[model samples]
Target: MGGLIFIFVQVLVAVFLCINFMLITTFFTKEFFYTTMRYILFAVTLLSDCVILIVTNLLIICNYLKITMNLWLCAIMFILSTVYSSVTPFTLTAMTLERYVAICMPLRHGDLCSTRCSLHCILLIHGLSSIHFIVDLSIYFASTSIKFYKQSMICNVWIFILYRWQDHLRNAIKTLYFLFMCITIVFSYVRIMKAARAASGEDRKSTWKGLKTVILHAFQLLLCLIQLWCPLIESAVLQTNVKAYINLRYVNYIIFYVASRCLSPLIYGLRDEKFFCAMKSYLLCGFYKKKNVI
Candidate 1:
């Protein structure tokens, strides 16, 4: 049942992403060159996440059917998840920084977030995400010790327990990395908010828009942290009911993923008056065409 719901929500996200990609690409072709680059970033991010969703959902289906989800399958899922989890925040973080400079330093934003600079930023983000993926996945697969635990009535599972100090060290480092990113996001937003608060005259509305952007990314970061990290923290530290915790956490995970994907385009489309008008016009024309054909 959980697997079914997960697949349903993820599929919806994939569809939403496809729509958003089309809209972004079309708009970019008609607008700024840098906007084209932003569209490319969004398209790649959506495609990568869609692949992760499909593969992970398939793994869940195999598990539900009482088939042995092969270790290799698990490894693939782990790599995909690592890529999704790590890459998403950084991409969003970069977007936030882009918006910040565009608003606060419009004259310099072009020079600062140039095509080369943007590509470099993306490369740095992917490089970091890849490094984390390799380290964590390597540690996961290399461990030989196993500990068994009963999960929900649908799935009982055993997991490899990593007990060595070095293993703990790696885990701590990963946790701290995420923690640092979260802190950076918050701190950046704080500065953005301060700038927003200090604005005057006609620029105030633009400042508010900037503040909204910060809020949107902040909400996303918070949601991702809560969905991804909270469960592991609770299970490991508090020795909670693992089954209940996992089920609850998985529900939130699906909710957050769907929300994040769908919200990205919807929020941007509505918030940008030009995009909103374009979307409205597009939808209305489509509806008119369908009605006439019918």
Candidate 2:
């Protein structure tokens, strides 16, 4: 029964990711949303996360179905997943910084946060985050002692990073990295709030919108940290044997993977008024077309 439920939720999450990907793609393809570099950053992050969601859900579903998920290709997908997920936080931080500059340094924002610069920023972050992926790959090859704990179904690659690798160092590094990002995120928002607070009475209304957006971005970051970076879920396989609450492992997978995927676009991406309006029109038109067909 637990297995059945896991598979069901896994399928639902996959469907959710597909729908979001389609909507996001439609949002980007429309010419109107090309107003700023932030949209491009959101698009890249949304698409990458959509890919991560699909891959992670597939792994869980395959494992639940008693299928062999371990393959050379699986390892590659795992690294890709790690890379994209790792890069997502930095992309989000970059977005926040872009917004900060736009609000607090409006005059300079035009020259600074252009689309090309944002793309380059994202690429640089991706390149840097891949250091973890590269290290994981090298250690994976070098250490014959490392092995996947296959006691249960739904093998997540994070399980390998925790159990197989020099897990202590990795976990500490991961914890610190996430911490540093969170601090940077908070500090950026703090400045935004300060700017909002210190605004001239005449500019208060405009400043408030910036404050609201920054708060929303911070909220979304908190959600990401809580949902995806929880030590309980990440280190759970290492701390406890897989046989114990093995079924709960699937629940954790659903909680972390599905929730993270759902939150990113819905919370972060949709917060853009323009993007949301475009999506609303796109979705409503599609619904009407299907209704007319029916």
Score candidate 2 by TM-score against the native.
0.81
Which tens-of-lDDT digit does each residue in 1-294 have in candidate 2? Answer: 676767677677768777677767666667655557777677766777777777766676676666754545667677877787666667777777887887788899978887678667877888876877787767766754435422333455754463533666656666676787778778777887778888878576667776676666666566656644455664566566655455566666566556655666765456656777777787788899999999
For all candidates in order, the CA lDDT equals 0.63, 0.69
Worst 10 residues of 1 by lDDT: 148-157
Q: For each candidate, what TM-score against the reference?
A: 0.74, 0.81
- Backbone N/Cα/C clashes per model: 0, 0
Model 2 steric clash pairs: none
Residues 169-262, candidate 1: write the lDDT tens digits. Answer: 6457557766877777777677777777788886777877877877887787666665545545546744656566546655655666656655
